[model samples]
Target: MEAVVERFLKYIKCDTKSDEETGVTPSTPGQMEFAKKLAEELKNIGMSNVSLDENGYVMAEVPSNTDKNVPVIGFIAHMDTAPDMSGKNVNPKIVENYDGNDIVLNKDQNIVLKVKDFPEIKECVGKTIITTDGTTLLGADDKAGVAEIITAVDYLIKNPSIEHGTVKIAFTPDEEIGCGADHFDVEKFNADFAYTIDGGSVGELECENFNAAGAVVSIKGRNVHPGSAKDKMINSMLIANEFIFMLPDTETPSHTEGYEGFYHITSLKGDVEETKIHYIIRDFDKQKFEERKYIMSAIVQSLNKKYGEDTVSVEIKDQYYNMKEKIQPVKHIVDTAFRAMEECEVVPKVVPIRGGTDGARLSYMGLPTPNLFTGGYNFHGRYEFIPTFAMEKAVDVILKIIELYTKA
Candidate 1:
């Protein structure tokens, strides 16, 4: 458990923030650097077939010691943290024996993690908690997952007497930007089923995620001098603003939760000459997801009609779909994780993921992968933290899941 904490702290220190604007695999050079370091660590731990691919995915195998044939199961976690916040110089503050009080993260900046705002802190009372400095995000979102998987495999290597089947481990990059599965070679992974250690909170087991799409709204307007402009100048920024106001305000990320769909305007930039607006649409139901995209198209059509022809152009790309459609056919895979959690004394909390994971795309790629918890909370921001005990429990659950498979 201490080893898990040490491994997590060590991994988070590396700056591996993914960039969506990079337009390249791994998205950033830091991801490739981290991937190489992880590959070396895997080889040193005696894991066989250790390889880091060109796209910064690290894959390794823990060979079976038992004579009995057991199903191969893989554990996956992303290497890169979300690009929403800074990942550089993450100074983790460990709260030894949390007292269920507000934790002052940065005294100089007056930044704090108040229990009143995040009441979940009360649940972690008496447990060791890891938080970040006010300046940067704690990369526990999936770094904790990475450490837990490595620590579990390390434990198996040391305790070879514990009979188990072959276990596959993978660390992916650019998951934050939804490209983790884009270049993943599922055929090469050679696992019957896998689990992504990328969920939030303890005891979380998610098989369903929102069907997602990215919308890029491009607006082009003719620029004219104000003195000579009379219906000759069109403000593209104002048109973009009008387009945003057309979407339902009540159906946004802040207003919705638990299967409720939303249209999230991620970014808007430009001026009268040209403006571009970026949005992401999410819905659990496939039909509703399609309708949301259709609504966006209809709005663009109306805008273009009003502003003349070809003024508003939209490019909507489908990012990923609900994994429930893929996982439901193989129900036992989820059951195995549930049983593993219970056996490890962690209560199972089966919930729908409000966001997608690399596992969702993997499931569609013929590997029915579901998501498991990394014990992280308030991910992708400065207030992000994780319970040390929850991380330890996650490692235990991974080992128990492997043990259960061997018995089966």
Candidate 2:
């Protein structure tokens, strides 16, 4: 447990925030630096076949200790933090024995983790927790997962008497930007199945995620001088607003929950001459997902019809899909994780991921990967936090999963 905490604290300091506009494998240099550090640490922990590829993927193996033919299980996590917030100079603060009250992250900045907003923090009463100092994200989104996996593998190596089959481990980069699996070598990893330790909260066990697509809407407008602008000026910013209003107002992230999906406008930038609007469409059902994309296109077509031909254009790209489609045949993998959590005295919450994970894409790549919990909450923001006990419980669950697989 101490090792897990130490490793998590150490890893967050590397500032590996991913970038989407870089058009590079890692999208950022810090990811490669973190990968190199992890590869070296894997070798130091006596892991075999340690390799850090050019694309910033780190892989290693834990050799089998028993003659029994057990399925090779892989545990994976990402190396980079979300680009939505600052990961640099992440000053984390530890709260010893929380009292279920609001946590003052930065008194100078008036940043408080209010219990009324995030009631989940009450669960950490009488337990130690870690949080950011209100200026940056804590990087616990997947770093906690990374620490748990490495710590579990390290424990297995130290206690060779605990017989187990081959275990594969990997740490990927740019998961935040949706390219975590772009260069992944599933065949090279050579595992029968894998689990991504990247879910939120302590007991979460997920196999379903939103079918996703990204759409970019470009609006071209004619800007004329205000004094001479009768019907000659077409304001692109106003047209962008019209495009936004065309979608269902309630069908948004803030207004939906559970399996219900929504259209999210990630960014908007432009002026009267031209405006570019970036949107992400998500739905659990494939048909509904397609409908969402079609709706966006329909809106663009209608706008172009009213504003003349070629006035509005849209480009849409399909992202990852629901892993439930891939994991249904291998349902036992999720069941094993459930039993492992129960055996570790942790209640299992089989919930659907509101957002996608590296597992979502990996499952489509013939790996049938599911997601496990990392005890994190309020990710990609300043209010993000994780309890120390929950992280230790996650490591225990990981070890128990391996133990159950070996005995099976």
Candidate 3:
């Protein structure tokens, strides 16, 4: 357990924050450094075939101890942290024997993890925890996942009596930018099934995620002098507003939950001559996901008719889809995870994710992957933290899952 926390602390300080604007495979050089370090750690733990590729994906194999034709399983976690905040110079604080009260993260900045806001913090009473200062994110989003998987592998190696099948592990890059699975080699990964240790909190086992797509509305307008702007001036920003108004006001991230779909406006920037509105259309249902994309195009067409031809242009790109379609065929993969959690004394909370995961894409890519919890909370922000006992439980869960599969 101490080793797990020590490894996690070492990882978060590496500053592997990914950049979406880089137009490169990793989008940041720091990710490569982290991948190299993880590969070395995997090799050090007696993992075979430990290799880090040029695309910044690190892969390794743990051989099966028994020869009963067990299925090849995989565990995946991302190496890059979110670009939403600074991952550099992360100074993590360890709090032992939490007293179930507000935690002062930064005394000078008045950054506190208040009990009034997050009731979950109180759940870790008497347990040790790790948190960041008010300055930067803790990078536990997937780093914790990475640590848990590796720690479990190390345990299996140390205790050879716990028989298991072939285990494949991968650490990916650029998951925060939505391209984690873009260049993934399904054939090379070679797993009958997989689990991404990327879910938030303990017992969060997710197999369903939103079928998603991106819609970019480009508005072309004519700027004219104020004196003669009565008929000629077409403010693209006004057109963009009309497009936003056309959508269902209540159907958004802020207002929706539990299988509810949403049209999120990610970015909006413009002037008199041109305006661009970036939106993400999401739904768990395939038909509704398509309908939402059509609605965005319809709104653009209506405005184009009101303005002129080519005045409103939309570029719709399919990002990723619901993994439910892929995983439903292999339901027992998720069931095995639930049973594994129960074996670890962790109650399984099977919930549908409102957003997507790299597992969602990997499942569609023939991995049949689902998501497992990392025991971290408030990832990708300054308030991020993880419980020490929760991580120990996660490592136990992984070991138990392999045990169940091998024993069967």
Q: What C-alpha lDDT, on a 0 to 100 scale, does residue 137 get in candidate 2? A: 96
TM-score of 2: 0.99
Clash-forming residue pairs, model 2:
none
Please give, for residues 1-408, the per-residue lDDT of candidate 1 as tens digits. 799999999999999999999899989999999999999999999999999988999999999899998999999999999989999999999999999999999999999999989999899999899999878999998999999999999999999999999999999999999999999999889999999999999999999999999999999988999898897999999999999999998999999999999999989899889999999999999999999999999999999889998999999999999999999999898999999999999999999999989999999999999999999999999899999999999999999999998999
State in Å the error of residue 274, model 3: 1.9
Between prediction 2 and prediction 3, which has the larger TM-score? 2
- Which candidate order results from sorting by lDDT in descending order? 2, 1, 3
Summarize candidate 3's per-residue lDDT along 1-408 as a digit string, tens digits.
677888888888898899877899888999998888998889888999998889999999999888798999999999888888999999999999999989999999899999898899988999998999879999888899999999989988898887789999999999987889988888998999999999888999999999988888999888999789998899888888888899999999999999999999988999989999988889999999989988888887888788899999999998888898899999988999999999888999999987777998998888899999999998889989999888888888888888888878
Q: Write the per-residue lDDT of candidate 2 for residues 165-272, one digit (tens) a residue.
A: 999999999999899999999999999999999999999999999999999999999999989999999999999999999999999999999999999999999999
lDDT of 1 at 146: 98
- Candidate lDDT scores, in order, read 0.95, 0.96, 0.90
Q: Where is model 2 more than 4 Å wrong at Cα?
A: none
Q: Estimate each model's TM-score.
A: 0.99, 0.99, 0.95
Count of clashes, each model: 0, 0, 0
